[model samples]
Target: MSELNFIVTLFIAVLGPLLAIGYLKPILLVVLDSLCVEPLPGKIGAHFWVRSACVLAVAGALVLALSFGEFDGSLMQALRRALWLAAAGSFVSIAFITSRVWAPVQRRLNAQLNGGRG
Candidate 1:
């Protein structure tokens, strides 16, 4: 039971983000790309942070609820396991998104500072 829970938790942590990106990446990209103040996108970083946190929080709550119950072979158990996997995956996905969004900007900024065209 413990092993199952651990595996489910790990799966959730890993897979949730992958799915999130697969589904929500376009929106994320648009938000990130529209960050320039000249065009007035209205502060994407704050909006993105809030949206990500809300989604993560809801997914986390579902995972916690699913993973805390007694062991059983019922349908609820199966759903709970699935939710656990999703939660874990969601976290991983966000981490990936964060890095993806920040890495390029950081590199470009560094290049500009170094007198490069970026």
Candidate 2:
């Protein structure tokens, strides 16, 4: 691929999963909330794992679906690419969620440690 094409492809590969996760996360949270599923007390790990699984599943399925037609080359190669993209997307989504969840907590803890000056 030309440099321009490579850059565009890279951009789409990185952004696609983020956009998918961004759109799906709120919907998933709403559905879970409506089901009255409460987070385990003092247990963020379980929530993180569940969310990670969900992100992987959604990203994988989307990649699989789109790969058949959207990607070039042999089936196996396309599948390999799809899986890699899905994994990358899941990691990005998880990192984003982690930062969003922890940033405020970190700030609050800092404030407490510094005698409420933060």
User: What's the TM-score of every candidate structure?
Assistant: 0.38, 0.42
Model 1, runs deviating above 4 Å:
1-19, 31-72, 112-118
TM-score between model 1 and native: 0.38
Q: Tens digits of per-residue lDDT for model 1 on 34-95?
A: 54444435556636554665466446645554556334455456557667656654565466
Candidate 1 local distance difference test against the native:
0.57
What is residue 80's positional error in candidate 1, in angstroms?
1.3
Against the true structure, candidate 2 reaches a TM-score of 0.42
Model 2 scores a C-alpha lDDT of 0.53
